[model samples]
Target chain A: AQTIHQWPVAEIKAVGSPLSLGCTIKGKSSPNLYWYWQATGGTLQQLFYSITVGQVESVVQLNLSASRPKDDQFILSTEKLLLSHSGFYLCAWSPTGVEQYFGPGTRLTVL
Target chain B: QQQVRQSPQSLTVWEGETAILNCSYEDSTFNYFPWYQQFPGEGPALLISIRSVSDKKEDGRFTIFFNKREKKLSLHITDSQPGDSATYFCAASAGGTNTGKLTFGDGTVLTVKP
Candidate 1:
């Protein structure tokens, strides 16, 4: 079985503050990891994806960065948060990069 | 641009009734379609999916009817129940050849009355 875990299930931060969200995958080796953002009740937007360690690709410009430091971990971070960065952050993993399994998710609120 | 679109921003159905959710894509390059079901405060789950090569895909009570020519698809939930109430998102991707970057629709909220 595969398990995806995200840290700090929810966060409330002020604008311009730095933010970091982490995701870890267990029981699956070398799985593709992806980060997505969604507004409250809105469609999901793909932010970034990592096919291998030390290699990350950005799909859309969301003022955020992602890193795959280890085969089992993917991290999303931002130097400075904007008001528009508030929303739900989701981490997903896929073996074939087509059928994906999503994590529980992290809710972010920027004031 | 919103490449993927869903119809009937909201829908309501009774128990044992059938609920139909519609979706369409504007991009011709999109060849993969997947439907996701999301509950409040949770990540969306892959409900069912259909490739452009196939017109229909069924899994138990959930079925996907696709029309490649029309660039449209519909999700039919038969024997609907209150537990089936949630937001369904229609998503599209280019193909399996590239990284899976899915374009999502706004989503349709389905309410099932017991």
Candidate 2:
């Protein structure tokens, strides 16, 4: 069985502060990883996706970035947070097609 | 392009009743359609999926009906229960030769009463 893990379940930061959300996938290798953001009571939006190590694609320009430092590790970060950045951030991993496994997610609140 | 769209932004139904949720897509390339259920404070989970080649797929009380020609699909939940209350998102992906990148709909919040 494969499992995905995310950290800090919840975080509250002030505007202009930096943000970092981590994700780790167990039991899968070279899986496609994705970052999604959902505003309060809104639909999920694709932020970034990575197919392999050292390569990440930005689907939306929300002042956020992602990196696949390792095959099973994905990180979402921002140098300075904006008030609009507050939302639920989800990390997902897909082996190939259709089905995907998602982590618990990090709830960020930029005050 | 907001490839996928779901109807009834929110719905309320009584227990033991049936709840019908609708979805439509604009991308003709989409061959795989999946419905995801998300509970409060939790990540969305794959509920059921149907391939474009198939007209219907069923799992327990949940059923998915696909119409490739009309570019429409729907999820029907029979005997709705309070536990079945969650937001449902419809997603589509071009299955073959594609990376399984899903384009999701806005979602419909279903609330079931007792």
Candidate 3:
């Protein structure tokens, strides 16, 4: 079975603060990883996706970046938080295109 | 282009009644359509999915109907229950991409009443 884990389930940060959200997947190697943001009552917006280590692609530029430091780890980071960046962040991995498995999302509130 | 669009921002259904959610897409390249169910704080789960080559797919109480030419799809939940209340999202994707990125719909909130 495959399992995905995310850290700091919830966080509150002030504007201009740095932020980092981490995710790790087990039981899968070199799986496709993605970072998505969901605003209040909004759809899931894909921010970034990575297929291999040390390679990442940005789909939407919300002033955030992502890095694939390891085969099973992907991170989303920002040097300065924007008030509009506040939302529920979700990390997902897919072994195949048929379905995607997601971790418990990280709820961030930027004041 | 907002590849996908879901109807009825919210829905209310009586217990044991059927709840239907509609989704349509503008992109013809989309080969996969999936319906995801999400609780208030959790990530969306794959409730059911249908491929472009097939007209329908079913899993237990959940059924997905697909119209390839119309580029429309719907999710029908039989015998709704209070536990089934959640936000349902419609997602579309192409298969050839290695990134496995999905285009998602805004979502519809379903409330099952007893």
- Top-DockQ candidate index: 3
Per-residue lDDT value at B69 in model 1: 90
Q: What docking tier does model 1 reach?
A: medium
Model 3, position A91, has a per-residue lDDT of 96
- For candidate 1, write residues B13-88 as lDDT tens digits: 9999999999999999898898999999999999999999999999999999999899899999999999999999
lDDT of 2 at B49: 90
Better of 1 and 2 by TM-score: 1
List model 2 lDDT by residue over A1-111, tens digit each.
889999879999999999889999999888989999988788888888888899898989999989999999999999999999999999988888456667888999999
Quote the positional error of residue B92 for candidate 1 in Å.
0.7
Of candidate 2 chain A, the 10-residue stretch with the lowest lDDT total is A96-105
Candidate with top lDDT is: 1
Local distance difference test, each candidate: 0.94, 0.91, 0.92
Report the lDDT tens digits of candidate 3 across residue range A45-91: 98998889999999999999999999999999999999999999999
DockQ class, candidate 2: medium
Error of 3 at A56 (Å): 0.5
Name the 10 consecutive residues with the lowest summed lDDT in model 2 chain B. B93-102
TM-score of chain B of each: 0.97, 0.97, 0.97
Q: What is the DockQ of each candidate?
A: 0.75, 0.60, 0.76
Reference contacts preserved by each model = 0.60, 0.47, 0.72
Q: After superposing candidate 2, which stretches have Cα over 4 Å from the reference?
A: none
Every model's TM-score:
0.98, 0.96, 0.98
> Which one wins by DockQ: 1 or 2?
1
